[model samples]
Target: MSSFGAIMVSFPGAAHRQFGKQIYTTLIPFGVMERFLMVDDDVQRKLNKRRVKSIANYILMGIKDGNLCFLSAITATCRGPIQYNEATNQLSIDISTQMSVNDGQHRFAGVKMALDTMRRKVDTSQGQQRLEYSEKLKKLEDMAIPVVIFGNLTKVMEQQLFHDLNLLANKPTKSVSLKFDNSDLYNAMAKELKNENEWLIRFGIETERTSLSERNRELMVLSTLRNMISFIISGTDKDSNAVLTLENYNTWKTDVSELIDKLFSVLPEDCNDRSRYIIGLAATIQGIGKYINYLINKENLSDEKLSGLKKVDWKHTNPHWNGAGGTFDPVKERIVFGGTGGGVNGIYMKLIEINGPSI
Candidate 1:
């Protein structure tokens, strides 16, 4: 059994020690982290930030004691940021919505306190724990913090530590930037695939008793493809170089199919073919990659390479549509973007209507 789980509760400060132990021991085995949602009133909000952080400290303290907790956010939607009160030695939330949400508010406040507690207790020789706060925030004019949660906590924790230690660090807002250079995108895509494969292999080895491994592996691959495609299309106008122009979009479309084929071949045959097909179309539109590097390398690249690129030649493989005696091409048969037909090569993929769960 994997030791990961999450739970919600009405009480914010209860069962902290035991809860922490369970998180480290039981939940870790199950690959779970229990998330507690507690309701606090305005009075609780006004308390010293340390008091708020104590709740997190107490829970994490339990996890530390039990040796069961390792902070991670692979399965949750969470954000973290630090808000500072210049006048008081307090840090308030920059985004108060998290504070409004019962669970999020406490989680944020508790995380800060946990770091503070750990930092103050540090002995140079005992260095089992590291101090994370720094003094950089004192120089900034804007004291507000961006909202962070779950996986993002890793960064937030570091940022808070930088602040606590009176060290200057990168702003929390800057750390979350997803801008990709053309080459960086390809490296990211490759790394993403490698990570997915590792997850697949682990799931296979760890869940031998059940067939859940194959399903999980497929889902991860599919998700990576979806994310990669979106990353490519996102902010193309602002961040893209001259290479990603509409003239070459068609070839990019074909490359997307090739990329999907490569991704699918890496998966176990147990995966559904329908997912494979949809993923191919999605990848052409949203992949984050460095094909532009190749274009730059090939200075002689001419119109011949891009001529047939805009065409979506794939036959529709949807069993449901075929069963109904309908033949609708899932490709550039429809208009997209500002183009009236075939979406001016694969530019249609960028059109808002090409909807799928991947988005």
Candidate 2:
């Protein structure tokens, strides 16, 4: 869309939400929304050859409203504070850690998306000239948006910024466990898990983990989806039976449905995309498993206590084992516990007490 009369558009939601409406309602028919492409970094990367087919299939099957993408600079800034200057048509962002130009590509994409939607024209002819102009635009992208992040932020200020971004993104905090209690095991596990935050974002929404009402639920859904996806993408023909046999378009739909009915049913009604919720729950549950195993393998839990444990309910285990041991008990969902081992030490029978009126 080419325009001499410059108009800037900014919003609190994704650029698609803003521009989609504008293009459909005002720009497209008028033929104003044309020159610039409104692309998110995340969207572009996932559009590659391999993912393209699956992504197309997913969209066609209505499996995902939005797919995972490369982390964008605009999204990366959620940890910091943001200020939008409507008057000057700028966004100012500040972070404790200075991000490089390459790292800021996604943020630049956000601006590009905005400019595209607003029908701003950039001179695209010169190689060096284009870089120079974009460099200047990059500065505007950074200065116009204000974001500040540090370990030393005041609790209240940090919380305020955190919440503002969460509400803006419509994030749910139902996935992270142990956030509220801050239990010793949870703290240790969370610290370790954060180390893998980058890789974890591939199948999960790392940015919005803390905003859920039940972080465990979010974690559960994510972990399961990742595992399921990996199983499909990396397996031998037999192992990846789901993807190999089903038409590509049906794969995501069936898998997502099963995942939702199994994992995220614990959540209350009203959440969008039950599939995303399932993915989050799976991630949280896997996190619990990773952490619990960390404790178990580290010998953090005493041998006696570990031995005394006959069964564990993964479902009841926070952040992990939501399927507990993955066994169905007909009436009960899933149960986990120790089975009999070769005994000279003898077997420990752990009795769990359940409450119900006697029939």
Candidate 3:
């Protein structure tokens, strides 16, 4: 019979022992533990490919020799153990028995896939390279993932645990995460901009997940501003290479801050008047940011040359926006910035048109 070995410590919390219950916890290696941790089809959430890939990338990037990334313990309900020794605090988990993962199924999947990928890479390498890859694969396989084994749980209890783990926890919104993420250059810049600009703070720029509710609010969401800054600096929203390296942070920061200040100063006093101007719309702002990036990178336009943006007719009612796939709806008195790629391209082209032959 196949078995997995673990050094079990008495589970924490008095509540675990109150009902004449004894619980044990163990940190198991990925290679050995992956077999037993089964994803229950009925209880588990549907797997998201994007999320799994992102997690796997994080693990690959973060984990190194003599350094390890921390992942929260995986909670699971186990069938009764095959055997345990009171003296040694060692436990044997039978491979034949059933175990259902109550939480961290995505994490489990990501780790397993990452290990497999490493193994495949190792297998394909040759000579010294093979040895290096093998070492990394071994390290990943031996990575200890803490697992809390709750024994003698009924089906109902398992279901309840699953529900509690997935549903009860409050997940932070993207805006909140971006606002608090000091590590990201764009996020840090957004925070700095908020602090530097009294007008933005006064307009009640939302740092949280919630959107601007009042019509009078001049600024968009904090995350939106972060994206705008990212586009302005990088020329593209997701271009990592365009970002300022640590060596030139101060220089880049000064440049970006100055550009942002100039851009904001020229905008109309009623920036939130979406009915009259496209500048009030979030999509329009993003489009204009991208266009500004193009002018900086492609045209090499100075701040003085950029002053021409103030002359453009930004109103949605302007005939310049009237085309086959127009963004403005005169009847509703609003600009309909569509979410599709075509819609975005249309807005970008319209901005380019307004900038004229010199742009």
Candidate 4:
């Protein structure tokens, strides 16, 4: 039932042998060929509505803005060998043949759904709105979906390809992603601090990944450092549009580095001992960083007054943390930190109480 004559185009390098041989493929428009793409009834992965809706929204936004581009191609394998005309350099695909999408089925479905939605909108609009929606619908129809078609692939080969593509794919962790992020001023500042601070390097900051190894001595994740730096510079855990400029970023970066250096210099000798002090914990560090911001902003504390934070006892054994939603386990010798919001607030209130009335 699908019309492939207008949409099909000869695409080279769709299939490559391990030893080095090139096979041909056909690139088709989703608008024309999506109905022909089939999934076997035995496939265990059911379509998730949440995922489909999310991806469909993303696709809709991209199509509206005219910036949707897929960097990776989708792949599908034929149940039987495809007819190829070597003399004409064309691959003949039969619409009746069972074509199993090996990967990107979700994306394909989302895009199809998004296109259908746009078509419906176009049908209901009037005048200028109708014209605009019509344009969008046309663009969606013409959108090229790159597909790598594999022919004569056995069931085992199809399963292996799917496993290799999805299961074996390596994605960078949050810390590594944040470390290399240049757009966010907080991430940039954290990376700079990691490079410049001898204390951070000595304490072993985790830059390459989020999770700490069992034997790893890293005291902070890069994402944690990012939040800390953001709070220290802007009195908030969010990037401020006011400090987005290069001049403001540099100034804030310098101030943050200086404040962090001073803060670390006065920390107790056991600051890095996770069992003794919450300072080593990421959530606790974020809470402390926020409290510091509060002191600098709300309490109008000078650098000298801020430095007086060293006088406060930050150990887990400090009675200031007892009761009032705070719990400590004597057996583990560690404060049982509450959930993120409650724990941060608890730490903040405790610090505020100890610091005592702005001097």
- Model 4 lDDT per residue over 43-90, tens place: 325777777776776667666443433525777776644655556666
Clashing pairs in 3: none
lDDT per residue, candidate 1, 243-345, as tens digits? 4434565565455445444434443354332334322232232321222212223323234332222232222353322222123445733211232122212
Q: What is the TM-score of candidate 3? A: 0.75
Clashes of 3: 0
**After superposing candidate 2, which stretches have Cα over 4 Å from the reference?**
1-106, 109-226, 232-247, 252-359
The residue ranges of model 3 lying beyond 4 angstroms of the native Cα positions read 1-32, 64-70, 82-98, 117-146, 154-157, 196-204, 216-218, 240-251, 272-276, 319-332, 338-344
- The 0-to-1 C-alpha lDDT of every candidate, in the order given, reads 0.31, 0.31, 0.69, 0.70
Tens digits of lDDT, candidate 3, 33-69: 6667788877777889788876676577546543235
Counting clashing residue pairs in each candidate, in order, gives 51, 64, 0, 0
**Tens-place lDDT digits, model 2, residues 194-227:** 3344333322344334333342333323323333
lDDT of prediction 1: 0.31
